[model samples]
Target: MARPRKPLLSRARIVAAAAALVDAEGLEAVSTRRLAAGLGVSGPSLYNHFRTKDEILEAVADAVSAQVDLSMFDESDARDWRTALHDWALSYRAALTDHPNIVPVLARGPGRRPAGLRVADAVFGAMVRAGWPPAQATYIGALMRYFITGSALGSFARGFVDDETAYDPADYPHLGQAHLLAERREKVDEGAFETGLRALLDGLALQYAAVVPDAHAAAGTER
Candidate 1:
């Protein structure tokens, strides 16, 4: 028979299938045999593209990282670091939120993933260019990663059971309306994220002033 126009299996195809499995059934559901079966190929064929399942999961995580928007870090953009950081955090959280199943692997840090490295590099480079000391810039990158990933790990509002009786006034006096939160999970979660992001940026702005005495004034002028 003639060679197929498209190769039956490739790295991209493997990563995509693995990612879909993860998204639908959590990380533990992915295995080379299952992935090959899903791809309609022999199990060993997947090894031609990926040596192991761990490597495939890493690629899936990196694919999620690539979805984040880093345009706010553009050198030509005159926005202050605070604004840029705020926008970047929002974008980062969004990507994580969409792929909550992969957040665990991503929380392990970039781990030599190309797209993940770009995210870290962009945040650190932008902070340094914005006049933050190198050490502080590094801290900012780590801090943002921790916050964004933690937020994506689970939904706070959904933590509360939807049954109104779950929060008894006798046992939990302050949680009178706690059960209502699950019904408004999206709004509550988003509001919490925004509130936390603003608080972080506001605190960072104060620190920026102390580190770069004229940064506040310059930022004001730019705005």
Candidate 2:
């Protein structure tokens, strides 16, 4: 019998399968045995590509990181750091939002993941090139990651049940309309992200001015 043209398993296929599993059933649902069954192969077959489940999960997380758009960091575009950072944060949050289950692993930092490292490198390098000190640039990278991942961890609006009685006026006087939040989850969550992003960028702009005295004038011109 001739062998199959397409191999039954490969590293990319395993990572994709693992990512799908994580997306559908959360990270805990992924195991070598589980992935093997899903891929129609024996459990041992996965070891040929990944040494352990953790390695597979790392690949999946890095794959999610690869989805983030880093184009805004292109120096040739000449975009102010504030604008670039804002756009990058939005893109990062979007990638994490789509794979909320993997945020936990990602929150642990880039580790040795190639794509994850690229994200960190881009943010740090962009900040430095934009006139931010190296130490502060590092802090900026960490800060953005924390904020974006925290935002993706869960939905604030969805936390409130749709039941109007969930927020009793007697117990929660200020949350009179809290019950309506869940129905407008998309709008509320997106608005919250934008509001937070703007606030972050505004604060950073002040810091940038202090570090680079001409930052205000340059920012005004960019605007």
Candidate models: Cα lDDT each: 0.90, 0.89
TM-score for candidate 1: 0.95
Using lDDT as the measure, the top candidate is 1
List where candidate 1 sits over 4 angstroms from the true fold.
1-7, 217-223
Error of 2 at 176 (Å): 1.3
Residues 1-223 of candidate 1 have per-residue lDDT tens digits of 9998756788989998999899999999999999988888999898888899999999999999999999999999877788888888889888888889999999999999999999999999999998899999999999899889999999999999999888889999999999999999999999999999888877777788788996563572222
Write down the worst ten-residue block by lDDT for model 2: 214-223
| Model 2, CA-based lDDT | 0.89
Q: How would you encode candidate 2's per-residue C-alpha lDDT over 84-201 as one tens digit per residue? A: 8888888998899889999999999999999999999999999888888999999999999889999998999999999988788999999999999999998999899999988888
TM-score of each candidate structure, all chains considered together: 0.95, 0.95
